[model samples]
Target chain A: MKHLYPIKESKQCELRKASPETIRFLLDYSKSLKIVSSRGLTFESNLN
Target chain B: MELHVDDASLVKNYLNGDEKALECLIARHNQRIFNFIYSKVFDTEITEDLFQETFIKVIRTLKLGKYNEEGKFLPWVMRIAHNLVMDHYRKNNRMPRYEGSEQFHVFAILEDDGVNAEKRLIRDQIESDLGVLVDRLPGEQREVVRMRMYQNMSFKEIAERTGVSINTALGRMRYALINLRKFIEENQIVLTD
Candidate 1:
């Protein structure tokens, strides 16, 4: 009974209510993660 | 001033070494970015993961000054989201590949839900082996496989581009796949990518 749920037709997407705080957190996390992982730097170094 | 600022301007500001500029760009476009990820996964949890992954990659690329300011930023990030979704599927081993006509048909028949995940995993492992076998094909056959399978080109399109007849294009792909399967059986290659 499973089917492909085409997202275009469904209306309950999470984007409508994405908050500013969430955006900031994700951006910060992404930046820090990339810096730490790619440069072999410590998380503490990127946190600042 | 905020209402009039454009994406290119924000990108330039960010590239000029302004951190807040990147934040503003994300806030402006995060909704569309979120929606792009959600559209592919159809699961809130997975969408969240991919959305984050997409931005992480975007931020890294922008920081490296390789974002190509000439291109529109929204579509570029959307392309990132789409690729992240595929990578997610690939990591989960649910990304069905196009090995031949039957595999290409609607992404490998969707695999009956009744088939347990373990069975699907085994089958996918086999398919992955054939994926590696692709590189071993003869020049003409390899071109046909890449064009027809990965690029999703029709035999007619492949024929026109490769300067071969449709029949020849189809023949090459068929032989390529047949040879791959034979090689897999003959060499006991494990499919994993």
Candidate 2:
């Protein structure tokens, strides 16, 4: 359902016009976020 | 394939000992929470601590069955982040003032192509925060805001891409600004000197 939202224009979200400070902050924030978010991302089928 | 769970499912799975499920939940919304915190405090290290502390509080609440899922997990988590940032400020005797100090016009930064690299780099963090907030706007409104503000597109171009009339596109833009202003004010998102 979430992905069903017409994503044709979604490519636009990837277009970031960030400066070095923002780039640094985003890199750090995203790194930690990805680390935490990936916790159950590759789970075994029977885990549920 | 059949069990592509959502945030709520991941959260439930976490409560049931699927530790990874909680990870997925954090992964999904951590940036949003981080964006909110970073915008308020404008400090990366403090933002990281608040991010972890926010999740700690969230995990504790979930373990105690205090999480009532009303289908808005991210915003709830963001509110927690917002509160924690505020609490830290209060404890430390510092609070974010609104535009009273000075406003860093995000749009001006984009429009003026001749800006110095040093200033651009400095303002980039705030721009990133502003971008995150704009993205939080609902679907069409978000689309319009991005096209108009970030992309620097004319209203006509926005209307064409969005398949709306000029007036409709204008309406969305208007509403987007109104909502963005309200969100910034309510959240106390500040701009520095």
Candidate 3:
């Protein structure tokens, strides 16, 4: 049987180590979105 | 500086109109969430993909105003990551043994009570998001897409309504989808389930 969940004793994730590319993608995608309220008004995400 | 801002406050700020708060919240919790996901997947690439999916779900929930946020932001995010991890396992046919009810009860909560409601919520959000994307197209193309997609109109009906030929309406929808795909690609957005 294969080990489904492997444990690496030597590895640890550091703080805020998320890839910049992913963050940039998320931010860009977020900015493109606008939340629409029940009244039909669009709210820009206002990332700036 | 948001150095001392709490999760609830950040969440509230983001909901109210400050998108930077979301960026701050993600940065603040990135390491912990990243580690939690990395521990489960043990592959940086897979962890990154799941991490993006987790936050994509988070952003959708927030955009839909579905997040209750009773000061449990981190745990809520952890739970989302956990579900995505389980989904990954199930997808890959590598599901591990469940620890116990203590650890697995979330599956019950999510599947039993939330799946349908959450799916509906996501569907609505995607509809609205697609509306925004459609609005970016030229006027003729936008009308064709709206008629076909939102109104569920046939090409013949759309042509009659728009006073264009059926082939023209069909051509417009083709261009609309092409433009929408281009925009989605340029933005790197995942529009489908």
Candidate 4:
């Protein structure tokens, strides 16, 4: 089976193992593309 | 024998009013096109609409003799989707942002558990944690992951789209994976196999 989670074979393991706090921090960084996409007045998919 | 033709040839045939050729082309590329659009917007419904729109634009532009057959057909369609995504951002005057630092909070958009709130909460927590790590990556790395993993773009296509060397694109992916791995380890989160 093709592995979706192929561990990176690199020396920079420290950055790879982000703390839960750090993970939460990053999610907060980028705002929602949905809101932006919607506000742009483009066609929204009704399939959702 | 099923007449085999390259994408360009098929496109040209479609341009010449061979309607079946267009159908063949759509069958060949729809899933890839859908994945590409989904990666950019991160919404299944939006991706479906954009997927349809991408093909419509392809048909319209091809009929108008606006596309250059010098490049592969999928890339041209991808360019259309990319432009649409960019236009979306530009018109809204907003940036793509997610909340939290550790996991992906975007999963909240997927959950609705009146009876299983606890399960939903746990899943959301994990996603939020992972989302944070992914978000902290450098811009180039993040873009590469978005294209490669989310958009399902090939290294060649990504290089072409971003106007970067293929090696550079691959290197960005490599670094992105490395950083993500580190982020996971430091957080002591076990991703299920």
lDDT tens digits by residue: candidate 3, A1-48: 246544663253333367999988787767667766766765646445
Docking class of 2: incorrect
**Model 1 pairs in collision:** B128-B191, B129-B191
Q: How many steric clashes between backbone atoms does each model show?
A: 2, 2, 0, 45
Task: Please provide, for model 2 over B49-113, each residue's C-alpha lDDT reduced to its tens digit, 9 standing for 90 to 100.
Answer: 78777876676666556689656778788888889987999977765543332567545444656
Considering only N, C-alpha and C atoms within 3 Å, which residue pairs clash in candidate 2? A37-B27, A40-B20
True contacts kept of each: 0.35, 0.00, 0.58, 0.00
Say which candidate scores most in lDDT.
3
lDDT of 4 by residue, B16-124 (tens): 6676776666656666766677667776666665665566566556654568855478888889988887887686576765565455567757666564877677877
**Chain B alone vs. reference chain B, TM-score for every model:** 0.47, 0.46, 0.48, 0.46
Q: Which stretches of candidate 2 lie over 4 Å from their true place?
A: A1-48, B1-4, B94-193
Ranking by DockQ: 3, 1, 2, 4
Error of 1 at B72 (Å): 1.2
2 versus 3: better lDDT goes to: 3
Tens-digit lDDT string for candidate 1 (B125-160): 766766678888899999999987789998999999
**iRMSD per prediction, in order:** 3.0, 9.2, 1.8, 16.5
| DockQ of candidate 4, scored on C-alphas against the true complex (2 decimals) | 0.01
Over A1-48, each residue of candidate 1 has an lDDT whose tens digit, in order, gives: 235777664765334534555677766764564333356543323453
